[model samples]
Target: MITDPEIDGDWDTAQGAESPERLTPRERARGGPGVRPWLWALGGLVVASAVWAGGLYAFGDRLSEPTLSYRPSKNLCEDFKARTLSGLTGDLHKQRPMNQESDHPAVYGAVCRLNNVEGMPDFVVAAQVDLHKKTDPSTEFDVPPLADIATIGDVRAEAVSDLGERAVVLTSFGGTEQKLKVLDGGAVFTVQVSVSTYNEKNGRPATDATAVQAAMIEDMRALMAALRK
Candidate 1:
């Protein structure tokens, strides 16, 4: 049979050889095989991987997206009044209930600040609720820098729990302050409660970090329990 000039052997001899084992080196070297079977297999595997990636890119939204819950309150100040302190009426004590609305209806936030009467301590509670339409399962909730992971019941937080129950605290965004966060449904609620005392002699704000933490924890726990109800 005719064979290509570049090939080392005749096409007939290469094709009709008894077996690969019997073929001479020259015969085995030519009829210039189009491509090896392993090469074909590798190409097929690559094609399959590409198809899988394309499919994922095209239809990923329909797969694995988490459905979140949304809850809105009309009167956040009245709701948090009793939970904050006894005989503390938002109306009676210069209560400032702040409300902010976003373009996305799924996102909602509210804050209620109860100021102290010059000598006593102050209390502020804020809540943010986000109902995400989609969620990344591979994502990680990274703890804030220089913070330790802590737990209150089943809730996890980044906090410092070195002090006794009288003062369990966590540092928050605004420097060293006590804070806590809890995840419910598809919503995350973060609460910060801090106490700052004036140093009569030093003329600067003085704080017992551990004591503040303990008080903040109690307030945070109370606020969380109230929100859940």
Candidate 2:
């Protein structure tokens, strides 16, 4: 077979792992027979490896990539339905499922707040959903209040208004907040989970806010778990 010399220029790998034979090209060329099988095998392996690597690079997007360990739970919104909208305008809290691939939609009257470990101020999340209206589903373009609680454009920040009966009523979430991101409209509504830690001093969370962040995440998880129903 005709093999390219460039692919496996050095046949060192072809030698057994614990091989003690030190054969050089000069010596082998002078010797009777040459290491053809090993050389060809190594060359084939190299070519195969190159092709595999090239395919991966070209199709990286289609490949499965590593992601966060936590996935969307089917029982994420159960509690919100049972206990959230109970007192507010009769049991009106809307319930929905959360997906791992994209952001969840807003449910009217579904409200939640989380406290950071740092004993900072609490963060509030208000769901401004249109359970009554023919609203679009998906997290892509979130409307104010329903899917978004916090609004900020450069040097401005505040909450939205005119939310329906199932709206969230909380202070601020934390520096870390969830956004509206809908892949395909599934009649799915968006819910804006507010995020903010106590600013006792400044409105934003402090630098050493890991504790607060952990608490917030914990609360969010708990709330989501309760919404499964």
Candidate 3:
């Protein structure tokens, strides 16, 4: 007969079967599915990393700057034209408004004179805008609305000349860093002449101009031909 069997220890089975071995901590976590579950976990981690990277790229895509628009005004002028050489005689009359004292609603004004007797506005190319009037003539140089009235600059007639019995003159104004010019083709007897350009903003010019100085000059020549009596 065999001795009494030891009951406190593990046992083995017949047919080459043995008791199960104790699993290590890592082995316990990876039991059953072995490396398959670890491979699946790694795949999930890679997919999460890829999604995170994609989101980061999308958020930072718009790193460029935006552009602004600025359209300030500047003046311009033209020199000689067709009716220069003719000789006008006698004193020209000042043209006052028939009914109204001023062109309050008008944006532009260009009237020629045969004489300087009338206390008229001498601005051949004046665009009377609806901004607060800037009365200052020093240092600061900009139109109204953009600048206070006291700091605004000027664009006015700077000189006049009577060449060979002709009332040719040079007009200039300095402000807003722009140089505007007005050319006068003096007086031919009872008819005097002047030309000016409107203020421009941005790249395009004002659709509404106050003085078509050059056009007025041409018209004055035609008028002289008709009124040469």
Whole-model lDDT values for every prediction: 0.46, 0.35, 0.29
> Per-residue alpha-carbon lDDT of model 1 for 21-133, expressed as tens digits?
76667757753243357876898999999999999987675445554443454555554543433222122245445544343543455555554333454444444433334
User: Better model by lDDT, 1 or 3?
Assistant: 1
> What would the TM-scores of all predictions be?
0.51, 0.25, 0.20
* lDDT string, candidate 2, 1-229, tens digits: 9986675635455544322255566655544234446777898999999999999887663342322222333333443342321221122232223322223333222232222223443333332222211233323233444423335422213322332212222223344554321112122233444344334332332432344333333433444343323
How much does candidate 3 score in TM-score?
A: 0.20
Each prediction's number of clashing residue pairs: 2, 37, 10
Worst lDDT run of 10 residues, candidate 3, spans 69-78
Give the top-scoring candidate (lDDT).
1
In order of lDDT, best first, we have 1, 2, 3
Better of 1 and 2 by TM-score: 1
The candidates, ranked best first by TM-score, are 1, 2, 3
Name model 3 segments beyond 4 Å from true.
1-96, 99-167, 174-211
Candidate 1 segments exceeding 4 Å error: 1-34, 37-65, 81-94, 103-106, 117-123, 136-140, 143-169, 172-176, 198-208, 211-229
In model 3, how large is the Cα lDDT of residue 176? Answer: 22
lDDT of model 2 at position 112: 28
